[model samples]
Target: MAIVLFALPLAVVVQRLYHDETVTGLERDATRIAAVVPDDLIQRPRPLKRPAGLPSRLTVGVYRVDGRRVTGQGPGRSALAVRGRDGRVHDGAEHGRLAVAAPVPSDEGVAAIVRVSAPYDPTGDRIQRALLAMAGLALAAVACASLLARYLARRLARPLERLTAAAQRLGAGNFSVRAPRSGVREADEAGIALEATARRLGTILERERAFSADVSHQLRTPLTGLLLGLESALERPGADLSAAIGTALDRGHRLQVIIDELLDLARDTEPARRHLDVPAELEEITLRWHGPLAAQGRRLVLDIQHPLPAVSTSPAALSQIMDVLLGNALQHGRGEVTVQAADVGGGIAIDVGDQGPGIAEDAPDIFARRSAHPSAPRGTGRDAGQAGTRTAAAAGHGIGLALARSLAEAEGGRLILRSSGPTVFTLFLPDTSMAS
Candidate 1:
């Protein structure tokens, strides 16, 4: 549309300019012929000599003041010749041709007139040719602009298209899909934002699944123990019913604690850290695990080095981690299970070690979710039989240490296997004073 608007006016200007140039040439020729006229031509009414090198398309004539033409190939009576009698020049269309007249000057006011006329076809043809050239150039500009517009549109749209597809897949729960990159900055930034959203959604979903599994595994022991104690009390003749009820209540309370801690671990946001007294914390864990270990003829020992610094961590997280370690030792270790806490520079270090045939050299990744503990004894849990123990190596150890390690990292701490022979696992927490 813009091109047409510009080209239409430009075409008109070209046509007018060409026509005007032709008329200007005629006026120049007429003035030249008038200048060289013999002074007695108006009185004699004879032929005037045509100018040298006059254009063939142009016709020249000498006319009287009353519009009578004497010499020229044009109408005998010319209106333009009569109009030029007042010592002025005039130009207009005359008999389908362009004509211009210049008056001759004499001592007496007005004399003869010189007229030049030409057919309009040549001027019209040149104007038409010029307009055609302009139209062709306009069309070429339109074509180039169209191609450039298409290229720009696709460059801006392709990245958004990819992001749309990725978002659709993500909405459908395919969290693995990623957005593509384009060179455009705005589109690339949008794609990056979409990718970050996908990652967060994926992490939240994974944590939810882990939360469900964690609840089941962590609650299994206490729940089973509660049920088994109640069953035993019913089976025994004249059993202490009140004592059995009290034991069941304790086990139920423990289940609640496990649930609360698991919920804390499963949240998308990190919990606030608190200063923990290492020895005091371990003392409570030992009290809880002591009876369970004693029932299996094993002792739980808590040893602490003096002047232990306060470590920063979530209290529930710390408790759960200790519970997992103690539970593991109870189910699979021999002799004594010792929890040793000491002041290590820049941090506090705690080691949970057991006297048992440690993890096998071949089974290096015991903390992996799918890896079965090679040193786990036969028929470890309540529901396991001899046959179950035979295949226990194939039944992966649940996400106990893995959950513990994750919880520790959330508190900005580290958990690692410091030894294999004695099966000592070390947990290091940054000292709260040092952190400050």
Candidate 2:
């Protein structure tokens, strides 16, 4: 549109200038012919001699005052000839041609007229050709502009398209998706920002998934205790309903505490750290598991080797760690469960050991998030059975130990497997003598 707007006026001005120039040239030729005309030509009235060097398209005529053409070429009786005798130059269209007339001066102030005219067809054709050239140039400019615009649009649009796709994938829970780069600076920056956002969102969502697994694993034990109490009450004849209800309520309260602690963990907030009575905490945990262990024809033994120093950690966190270990032992171990607390290296160490076939020595990283120890060789005594247990723990058992280890570490401690045989998992709390 802009090209057309600019070219239209330019073409019009060019055409008008060319047309004026042509008429001016005709006027000039007429003046020159009139200057050479004899002042007595009006009286002589014979055919005038033709001039040299005039354009072939022009017709020159010398006419009497009465409008009779007595010249080389033109109409026999010309209206322009009669008008030209007024002793002035005149120009107008006559008989489909541009005609100009100039007067010859005599003592009587006006004499014969010299007229020059050119056919309109040639100048009209040239004007049309000029307009066609202008139109062609404008169309060429428009085509080039369109192609360049398309190239620019695609250059910017393709990356935006990929970024949009990446965003959609992110929305659809595909956080690992990445956006491709575009060379444009602004577009590249947007891509970089989007990728960074995806990574952060990926990490956030992963933490959420991990939190969910942790919650389910952590809550399973208390839920089991609650269900066991309710089932035992149902199975017993003439059971004391109030006492059973009281026990179930207690279990529910403990479950709620565990949930609060898990929420604190999920939010990445630090639960208040205080001096903990390791012996007392273990005693409570043992009591909670005693019924379930007894129902399986097993016993849970808690042994405090000596007077233990208070450890600094979140009490609920410690309870959760112990629950995971006890749960692991109950599900996989054979003989009685032994939980022993002792003072070791100024920090407290609590070992939960069982006699079931121990974890395989060749087990892959057990603390890794949801890592399945898939390749341990099968055999007896630290072979197929323990490997299967480890695989079960990794695969269907969810991330109980992994979450336990994380909770221990969050309280400035660590949990590890001290022995593959007899499967003793130890929880070590850093010494709290100074904090106390």
Candidate 3:
């Protein structure tokens, strides 16, 4: 296809140039022979010798005005000669063969005419051979070009095929799949972008899965406690109706609190600018988890460096973040968990530290959604959904921490892993309450 597009025009141009050169040489030879005639030929007729460099097939004829071949064998016609005119070569025919003619000048005015002729058979055979050779060369060039085009087309097509497959998988909910980069520049660029989109989609999906699973993590503990309380009440002989109802109501209230916090986490709305009492929020959150920590034989300590001032942050967001931190401490930490507060900038810094064998140094990407504890089993909350151990073991830190940090930053705050020796994570919220 490429050969047809480019080679045909090239062949035409080459042939035209060659044909023009051949004709120009022929006309020039005729004029040269006419100019070199000796003066003695006018008085007495003599056969002209073939001019040097003239084709052997070309025959010359000298004629009087009336049209007669004086020496060579050719058609004798008066119109074949361009007499007493400028050096413009005109077409002359000699017995059905192509030729060129020019007038022979002398001391006498318009003395004689000389016509040069070449046999049509030989001239045409030479031209046909040249055309055949040119055609063959053109075909070879076209074949080579076709091969090159096919190679380039295949090179480009394979990457696009991979990209198409990747797109199909993406549409099929396989966001983890990626396309490999082909060496072709444009295809490589597209492949890079395709893989990039795949990574983004995979992140979004993993977060969604974690979000749904998070409900199980946060609510399962309270739900389990509520169930156990009802089960205990049922087991009692002649249980007091008012007492059971009160116990159930209390457990239900705790579950509602968990649900409301989870709902706030899922809202995806911007935080309202307001002053938050960090110490008060810290004390309340610690109190909520006090029972769970005491059950696990671990100590929960609060270290206040100063009279912590109020900062600009949402209480609901802070509560949810504390849940993740304290819940992690309860489930995974050893010894004691200390939550410290301090004054920093226009806000306060709250550090949640767990005295456990902190995260391993080689544990990859701290924020990417992946397993935190490789040995710990993963489940969908079928077993171990009790109040003491929620879904914390199954819900990895990657999902929890990533969400916590994103939420913190979205509300114009910062979350950082201060130290891994004790696995300390610090939270800082700026004072946005004064902003317009």
The C-alpha RMSD in Å for every predicted model, in order, reads 6.3, 10.0, 9.1
Per-residue lDDT of 1-436 in model 3, one digit per residue for the tens?
Answer: 6556666676677666655655566678877877887656656888888777777877777765455666665664545654423334565444767677676766665566667766666555665676787678778987888899899989989989998998999889887776786778898888788778888778766655766756665565556655665666677778775776686687687678767766666654545657777888889888766666776677889887877666777787888787777777777678788999887767778899888998888877666655444344322221222333322323456766766776687577888888887788898877544343
Q: What ordering of candidates by lDDT runs from best to worst?
A: 1, 2, 3
Q: For each candidate, what TM-score against the reference?
A: 0.70, 0.57, 0.56
Error of 3 at 178 (Å): 4.9
Tell me which of candidates 2 and 3 scores higher on lDDT. 2
In model 2, pairs of residues that clash are: 334-356, 379-384
| lDDT of candidate 2 at residue 432, scale 0 to 100 | 85
Worst lDDT 10-window in candidate 2: 382-391
lDDT-superior candidate, 1 or 2: 1
Tens digit of per-residue lDDT, candidate 2, span 79-173: 98789877888888898898988888888877788889999888889899999999899889999999999999999899989889988998998
Q: By TM-score, is 2 or 3 better?
A: 2
Weakest 10 consecutive residues, lDDT, candidate 3? 377-386
Best by lDDT: 1
Off by over 4 Å in 3: 1-29, 32-55, 82-89, 92-94, 164-178, 185-203, 216-315, 322-340, 344-347, 351-436
